[model samples]
Target: MENESPDLQLQGLHYLTGAPVRIAIRQGRIAGVEPLNDPPASLRQLPWIGPGFVDLQINGYAGMDFNTLPIAPHTTSRLSRALWSEGVTSFFPTVITNSEDAILEAVSAIARECEEDEAAGSAVAGIHLEGPFISPEDGARGAHSRAYVRAPDWPLFQRWQEAARGRIKIVTVSPEWPEAEAFIRRCADSGVLVSIGHTAAAPDQIARAVAAGAAMSTHFGNGAHPVLPRHPNYLWEQLAADELWTCLIADGFHLPDSVLKVAMKVKGDKALLVSDAVMFSGMPAGTYESHIGGKVVLTPQGRLQMADQPQLLAGSVKMLPAGVSHLVKRGLCSLGEAWEMASVRPAKRVGLPFSAGLEAGAPADVLLIEWGDAGGDGSEPRIAGVYKNGVSVWP
Candidate 1:
């Protein structure tokens, strides 16, 4: 072994195969790897090691709402460190529907945080604009404020993009508006990814949006009507379109086991797992007031809901790590496969280079997990350690 030896080395059973492997890191990136075919002379505690998870639709964490006014630059740095504890190394700080001024302010705040600190900057892959150009229908609008619901305005979006310093990678909108197709093309031409969400667009409208370069669906089973026609609904429409990559909030509350199973099978590698987590995530179980979802309650069952209407979910409280464990527990997918849905696949969709597992030249964004009775005990997989760029970043 060389001097300054990688900062650390983890020997563990492969997450999928359950075979021992040695992973080495150096200078915040994967430097080497070798199979440990035989047991070491003296063994130490080992856990499953894999690439860190990436969440494309995270809204906020630890009481920080991205849309909340007067956002501070330090908030992004704090949230990034907080998410590390949950096995997330990469995520988008999503800003949902809001007044144009509020949107620009929030973007500028987030941009300033990333622009100032390299570590904070790397954690924020891009900005996610989830609305202000979505359906006005009640159920379809989800928890986004109705007052802010309006048509798409390219000029206004350009201003927000300027404030975001061109870090606005994804935009979610409904294709129901007359200007939808053109707006999608404009966004795509500018190298931004457009997604459909909070929508009641017809099948033709959805197809047109896809034709105009809308590449994905945001939280497919959510931000829509509870009931739908058997055939031509937005859910089915997006599902059938191979051109559209779909994101699923697989935290159990957001999807039924049956639906999740079918969607995973159909989309195959294209399906991505997203937390869609709110500010209350990573917090204790209790009724908590939120800046966005007023009087939201965080239940012991891992469900975050409105206190006034227990039936309606106020975004998810489960982080991406829990979502991965839930899929494995429900027999929806294997540990390796489920983890990829939460990590590599999403990275690929966004054109980010990611390693399949620890490998030479790969960024040292990794997780050491103890797969403790996670399924039988109805508990989350315990994270033994989290590393970003080869450094222990988790408590």
Candidate 2:
């Protein structure tokens, strides 16, 4: 019924209270945004509004693994609908280290779907290829199959680009890999966002990569060997590299609260929140089998293994909204600050032009949330409703 409303009005939304505001939606696009007023009894009692969370890295959810199967044209659309229910109206379906055929097949499928229905696809903006060009070290490589790891080959990248039909938005690779700097330059020249991760790159190599055009660090603190003497590992180097935007899992399990705070401080608005949620994500906490990395045990504390040998994070069970909440709850940042990480920051990192916050003429992609009590130590916040392109897509 809400979707049927050609023109709908929402009042009483605080809009961070920097002056009162009213938002009007028409035909699934933001018709206008103006100062707030108590319109009528009919327009009252809607939840408070904010921008919808945009995740730049999501592997899979709802028992479907993106890397496990060659993504069919309909499969991405189905997953897009599923993501809408989770308050994500925009996401980049990340395909990690896998066979070349699988990568091309999956990318082709997603690109085809987006081409068919760009808006209804819930902002399938682009594809994130995490790797094949990365370190082969067991701990550093994490769950990626080492057999497929290789040096950055420009010709191979060109082939994958053709297969993807130019939908590859970002590529994460190890800076230390041979010819990586050159590849990073080529990627930047071609408008692909290049990120450094799954790496054991030396300080000089890290600097070189940053200079070359690697602008982000994927899941900064995770995917590394368990033991390290102290400062100056890949994590530290990435943090010190001021030019690189850093994305962190922030699901409490990936990085400690203190470490998360440090990362947030180091990167500031350059920090972005990513789910990295796997196929077992929306499933309940229990033992689950991952395709790349074998069996993993999930606990109430979130996923973990012995710290002595940090193998794989598999992926995150937390979604983008929850990850943003985690950042706020841990005192790492304020609610507005957290929201920026999930929405604007990632949009900028990937060079997306439509940074659709509550701006007039922007797409009417919005979220309404009921804030939880601040004093609660472990209480979870809630997403009351979500709208994509001015239409209520989830409740």
Candidate 3:
């Protein structure tokens, strides 16, 4: 007789309650979760069980570059499998601003990978198109190539969507253009999420975009002009808008702790975390050539910045797990709250099945995490095990 069964039981400390739990998994879904009858001698000895992270904006990871041209045949699949160790069971492969043909080719490659590879299909929930319809201003455009930046064009977007086989689910746009409201409405009507980002728009334009179905902000405080009017700026407008979900890069360097605290307080449950990671995410600290900025420096502190201009950030190198740990370390929020910002909240924002987490009938995209010590100075949470669709993917 076989000694193993398809059904599995995972025992750990519940992420939210910190109590011992036994989670039953069967047929790729969480069958049930109940308190453990026999607790471990020390609850602290058990790993923390929580939902696997859902990063809505991941440009690349572990030396994989989705934005780079001629994406290798195995890049998407490899990236998908690589993220398991980072505790990310699901993520949106972000394709940022590039030439028309380049953008089309990138997304098409991703779509083909999803269609052909089971791992890619299961891990990639959708594609996040971050540009080509964004601002052309120097600061507002961030590191995006200004030559390719232009006003929103529905026809161009439709072509990309068709090339993606309808896999482009989220788009980041700036409402500074006159045609933004109509574009936002069309995207929303088609059941696509339109995120406001990389903008130099007036406050009223931001408000109009919200009414036109722009549901979220992309890296809210990062991609903008360094200086703005005291009160009527887009930042203030976005902060006050109750309908917009805010995405923050809590990697400790992107935004200050005070800004993160205020945004979290204002957005509450609507606030979520995104890595906005680049290809150099997992690479060792050193100066490297990048397609976005000519040369970028990855500091030992995990900050990625423009080589010549250290004040300007190149991109985030920290993964979602690191962001969660930063939030907890800074006393901005509890560990559970930080984990949810990276996992549950982002999943909920995207309407993923596992948003309810380790409940009955939820997809078993779970993580067993090891917190080395319980203190403000504790080491980052480590991914001891990662389960995707009820099957262990990482160990």
lDDT of each: 0.85, 0.77, 0.91
Candidate 2, residues 1-395, lDDT tens digits: the string is: 23456888764454355334577888766667787665435333444576777888888887876787755446677788788767787899898887778778878777778778655245787889999998899778877898888899888888888988888889998999769999999999999999998888888899999999999998887777778658667778888989999988888788888888888888888988998888777777777666665677666666644233345455678887688778877777777788778887787777664475777667777777655442145656567777877778777
Model 3 spans > 4 angstroms off: 1-5, 372-377
TM-score of candidate 1 to 2 decimals: 0.94
Largest lDDT belongs to which candidate? 3
Write candidate 1's Cα lDDT for 1-395 as tens digits.
11233566767766666567888887878877777767555333457778889889778888776877888558888898889889998899999999999999998999999988766798888999999999999999998999999998999999999999999999999999999999999999999999999999999999999999999999988988989898878898899999998899988899898888888888988898999888888789998877877798888989988899999998888988888888988888888888888888888888776644566888878888877533556656888888787887776
Instruction: Identify the superior model by TM-score, candidate 1 or candidate 2.
Output: 1
lDDT of 1: 0.85
Clashes of each: 2, 0, 0
TM-score of each: 0.94, 0.90, 0.97
Off by over 4 Å in 2: 1-6, 18-20, 39-46, 117-122, 229-231, 304-312, 372-378
Clashing pairs in 1: 6-25, 28-389
lDDT minimum window of 10 residues, candidate 2 = 304-313
lDDT over C-alpha atoms for residue 283 of model 2: 76
Q: Distance (Å) between predicted and true CA of 139, model 1?
A: 0.8
For candidate 1, give the lDDT of residue 169.
97
Ranking by lDDT: 3, 1, 2
lDDT (C-alpha) at residue 124 in model 2: 84
